[model samples]
Target: MSQFALLGQRRFAPFFWTQALAAFNDNAFRCALLVLVAFQLGLDDHAAAIYTNLAPALFILPFFLFSASAGQLAEKIEKTRIIRWVKWFEIAAMVIAAVGFVMHHVSLLLVVLFMMGLHSTVFGPIKYAILPQALKSAELVGGNGLVEMGTQLAILLGMIVGTTTMGAAEIGPWLAACITIGVAVVGYLACRAIPAAPATAPELKFNPNTFGETARVIRITHADRAVWNAVLGISWFWFFGTVLIAQLPIYTRETLGGDNTVYTLVLTLFTIGSGIGALACEKLSGKRVEIGLVPLGAFGLTAFGVDLYFARHGVAPVRGLGWLGFLRGAGSWRIALDLMLIGAFAGLYVVPLFAFVQARAPREKLSRIIAGNNIMNAVLIVAAAGFGLGMGALGFSAAEIFFAAALLNILVAGYIFTLVPEFILHFFTWTLANTLYRVRADGLRHIPEEGPALLVCNHVSFVDPLLLMANLRRPARFVMYYRIFNIPLLKFLFKTAKAIPIAGQKEDPAVLQQAWDAVDAALADGELVCIFPEGALTRDGAIAPFRPGVEKILARRPVPVVPMALRGLWGSMWSRRDSALGRARLPRRFRARVELVVDAPVSPEHARAAALEARVRELRGDMA
Candidate 1:
């Protein structure tokens, strides 16, 4: 089903609107305040700058101070109740904001700014934590994509509406006040319909000391190296976005020589592209939380970012061009395409990371981990602001800053990928598998979502492991013949996947023993291990005798055993079918139709090699 279907479901629709409206109100109020200070208040430039600068700092301060507490609250209290309270808090803030707007009370508006920030700080944990509970494993990525799409569009609309509403002649302030409060109230009503998401750690002790709790949460977040790096990757995304967005206004004015209409057009293009990309995740990922897209996203962000600098780096000769006028000018299309792709890639980058964190983190501690992510995001956003200012201070053009950020993305992505090679490994396998074949996987649910499982599959081709890796919802370690595992070109991928390399007892008894020990250890540690019981690929398109290795491994670990089969691969590239002189033939057809069929998992006691081979043969049928 399309991810959009979730929007029509009671489980998702209400919460979606509540969060979207809150985003709208947050941006609308902030933009209205900016319009007031910059254009309406008639304050001098220096005074206006003070208020403008103070606003973000004040808003971000709450995240640094209260995120830990908010995380704890989300963990201890039922999520819907907290969300309702947060919505009420937003209404109260808007009430104060309404007064502040009518009286032109800068101090009061700033206070409301901080209040909205606090509101977001409190809502942040629940926003993510609730999703995993509400969504099935299949729905997690789609759900996150929907939320992200809503947020981007909401933020864009809010900015446009707020700016336009507040820019009106006389009724602007009152209108802005009315709109924010109304949105807040509607958000509260929407949130009331959100289904209850019970706390994950209700029986756990709550930590009240902000500093101590913050430290503890951070430590917990960092406990998993992959999760921690995902958090850092997320932070880097915020940093990149902050710099890109902060420069857009100036970029529109000085570089593009466009007025506000053009600015809005560019912003709209970016946001819409992001929405499209976010909504595409479920389709592209095959309804799975596929991290392979992260590398793809990182690549696009850097590529377009550099291209954006070159598309139009210098100041435009014409000034005050309207939206249509800007489009009519030279190179405008390139600039627009670059911005749109940048946003699209950003969507691809972030949604998976969020889902990965949700799927991988300990359920009970997930809220606190999300809080830690928020704290890191805030730090990077602040740093990005500083980066923009410093670059501008050094007389760098907006385009130069873009160039610098793109280059920095390369370094950042490299560092993160190095720290977690699984991302790169997944990317390689995902790309290879998707390019080589159209895969239809059935009965993936038979593999347990968590804990140890032994997967036995018929060996079909050289890329069997990659195919399975790409299709399996959960990660699994492959046990492969040592020669294949040590293939020079594929060595890195095999090592990163932690594939156990086995040798025949006659060829290398030591390696065989080590492989046996590794398989047992991995199972003991609660991980999935997949092995091909055929021992060698069949030269003919027929079932081969099942080796006794699977039985031996079961004897050691006794994990649940799942039988799997790969169909339509016997004649594909890298299979032995068309081989001559000990080499396989090139692919005769691109994107061959392939299917991974998994049967119900068998108990270890019943999962003998002959039985698994019979089941796999039954599953494969005459397809091979």
Candidate 2:
């Protein structure tokens, strides 16, 4: 089985069920209480509205109040132990929920909601931090995707169960109570299967004062711009979700003229879309934490959200239509479809931000940083609620609100792209190259993290430099021939990349001197400089003899030399041997797989052209 398959591994299954069960129980209890107050109990409309609003507030409140302390607990204790304790807390919360249901007490139910929030608050840091420990580095994206998909599915099922069961007179509350308790027990069992995840920061000092510690954690997040940016990205997702979910009841009742079923259908579609988008992350990202998808997701959100606004304008209010009836209604299905696609794109937009935070944050304080993120998310959600209410008060329709949010998403995404140019730049390059060809890279770890290094690869295809550029985390200055460097369409890219251009000694001595000086300067500044040591692309798909100039440059810098080989690029349309006159007759759809094999780094004293060539040949193996 593929490593990306969640069910194939013990490491992920436990945590997956644990998180899904928590989401299900939380929503089930909330929806059941809302149903009782709104329908069976015959509460006043104003009171019901207050209850509905307060339900979310109570649920989100603990994330702000207790997340800082929870972060501390997660950092100081083994995650498995913390998770077990949290599961017990869930069981207790469910029991309290059962009492609330039995007594028909609104106050008790509200209190239970708050308690569930607390349960989730304590689990938040552990939920994210545990993955980096339990999963392999490459599996992080896929694991996060599965967890997200499962959580959204759980939300959908919970809503369905809560709404359907609450209306039954004989077994409504009893069924809900049984489901809640059973799910909690199952969660506890799943927690038992989780392998031990030791605390990353056992020496962390715990503080009881929530406000002060919370402020301190927020400060730490702000100190790292990348982490804080990711936090903002996550918070924005919650903001969008809060608006979308909050408006569902209003849209279903006032706009669609439908009952509870329509509300549930809308929620289900949106959530299912999110699950699909989350699952797509693994395949789209090639199992890496690809931030490039964030921009693509942002684009889709704006496009579909705007389309959904227009779609909603065409939906007529329904009267007592079942699921199939609703699907057949004019524009109702289109609206639902748009909502689902918007949600899926939103998932695509957010999952990478989460992975980015986990991969990039200081491991010692990841929990606290995640706690800080929770605080921001809570604040943003509250802001979203306020924004929606304000918009409604100002006579804006739900469709208009969506339009405004979608437009605002464009501006916000633009600002973030500006702050992190790499996000947009990398996204552009990665999308283009990945769509055009299948790229396989090996021995990428040979690239040193914090030193000057020389990378020598056999040039094959026109895009070889770009393939290497995209996969390697470090920025490299490629030394290219003058003609290729000045290629009409690629010159801007080369200039932006600061590629060095050289000519032969007899052709242009001045250009050659400038190239040498640029290479020396880049190495002195601790940059990795790459060159096709074969001098030019091979004419017949064979590795050319190693050029001696690379040795001379390495001798001056005395840095490590990394040998890399590019495979399966020989037959590409962009290969040097491709006939220019016959280019129009080339195969229309070339789907070749290319691999970049990086051999172990060799020190200047130990490496020569012959040694480097031999190592490259070995890494290439059959392809060579």
Candidate 3:
């Protein structure tokens, strides 16, 4: 089903709107406050800047102070109930904001700003933790993409609506306040329909001390190295984006030489571009939590960020230019493109990381982990602010900062990639599968979400392992013939993947025994393992008799055995058909349609070599 289809489901649709409206209201209130400070409060430039900047800091402060407690609340209470409470809190906050708007009470409004921040801080963990319960594993990427897109669009429109309504001459402040309050009310109604999300850890202890809880929760997240790095990756995106957003006003005036309208236009490009990129993730990732795109996103972020600096540096002067005038000016389109692409890449960089956190973090502690991520994000955001200030203090222009920030991304990404080679390996496998074959996986859901399983497939080509690796959601260790395992270019890959290399018992008993030991150990530790029952690539485009190797392994360590068949690969480049010297050769099918049909897993007792071979044959059905 299309990712947009989620908009119609009661379980998801209501929650999506509730979340989207929350974002809309948050931005609306924030923009309204900034507008009041800027044009109506009678403050000097220095004073206006202080309020403008301080507002965001106040909004973000709750994330650091209250996130840990909020996460505990989410884990201890039903998510829908908390969402309702949060929505009600938003309504109360907006009501106070209305009074502030009328009296121009900066202090009252600042208090309301902090309250709104508190509302978000409390809702943060509930919002993310509920998705895994609500959506299937396959729906996660699509679901997250939709949420991310909605948030970006909401932010863009909220800023426009709030600022515009507040600044209007005849119906100022009052109308904006009404809209914000109305949105909050509607958001509360939306929360009422969010299907009850059960508390993941109802028995867990609660810590009222935010500081202690914060450190403990952060430790929980950091305990998993992969997840912690993913959190850092997310934090880095915020830092990168925070810097760009902070510089937009200055970039408009000094770099683009444009007025307020041009500034709005540029921000709109970025927001819309991010939405598009987010919506595209489901299709690009094939509905999986594909982290390969993370690297691709990092590449785009650095590439376009640097390009934006150059685009700004060579910008043609367009004094006092409005939106239309800026668009018509030289180098303007390039600048717009750079901003949009950068935002697009930011979406790419973040969606999967969010999904990975949801899927990987322990269910009981997922909310606390999300809270920890929020803390990290807030820290990075503050660091970004400091970086911006330091750059400005050092006399660096906005464009120069952009250039330097882009360069810094390379080092950060390199470090993250070094910490997580799975991301790069996934990219290679994902790209190779998509490029070389139009691959379809049938019955992928048969693979257990978490457990040991022995996969027995009809081996057709040298790249069958790669195909299976790419298609399977869980990683599986493959046992391969030593020659294919030791192929010069593939040796590093085989070793890195921890593929077991084996020789016949008569030739090398030591290698054979080690391979058996490794397979048993992997299964003991609850890992998936795959072996071709045929034992070697088919010399002809026909099925080979099943070997007893699978039977031997099953006898030693019994596990559920899944029978898989690879069809339509007989004519592919990796296949031995019509080849000289039995080497892989290219075929007309550059992107040949290949199907890996996985049958339902049978218990170990029922998965004898003869039975599995018969099952695979039936599935393959004379595809050759």
Root-mean-square deviation (CA) per prediction? 1.2, 3.9, 1.7
Candidate 2 runs further than 4 Å off:
1-4, 314-318, 440-455, 471-531, 535-542, 547-562, 570-593, 598-607, 618-624
Score candidate 3 by TM-score against the native: 0.97
Q: Which ten residues in a row have the lowest lDDT in candidate 2?
A: 579-588
Return the TM-score for candidate 2, rounded to 2 decimals.
0.87
Compared with the true structure, the alpha-carbon lDDT of candidate 2 equals 0.84
Candidate 3 lDDT over residue span 395-458, tens digit each: 8988988888899999999899888887777778888988999888889889888889999999
Q: Can you write out model 2's per-residue Cα lDDT over 1-624, one digit (the tens) per residue?
A: 254576667888878888998899888888888888888777889988899889989999999899999999999999999999999999998898888887788899899999999999999999999998887666778888888988999988988888778878968888888888888999999999988999988998899999999999899888888778878988988988888787777777666767767777888889889988998987777677788889999999999999988776534545666667777777767788798999899889999889888887878789989999999999999999999999999988777788899999999888887776656766777787787778777766678855699998888877887787777756689999998898997787787677999998998999999999999999998889999888887777778788888878976778888889888777667786556556622435755567888888888998888878777777777773
Best by lDDT: 1
In candidate 3, which residue pairs get closer than 3 Å at backbone N, Cα or C atoms, i.e. clash? Answer: none
Worst 10 residues of 3 by lDDT: 310-319
TM of each candidate vs. truth: 0.98, 0.87, 0.97
**What are the lDDT scores of the predictions, listed in order?**
0.93, 0.84, 0.90
Error (Å) of candidate 1 at residue 408 is 0.9
Q: Write the per-residue lDDT of candidate 1 for residues 76-127, one digit (tens) a residue.
A: 9999999999999999999999999999999999999999999999999999
- Kindly indicate the candidate among 1 and 3 with the higher lDDT: 1
lDDT of 3 at 288: 78
* Candidate 3: regions farther than 4 A off: 314-316, 486-489, 581-583
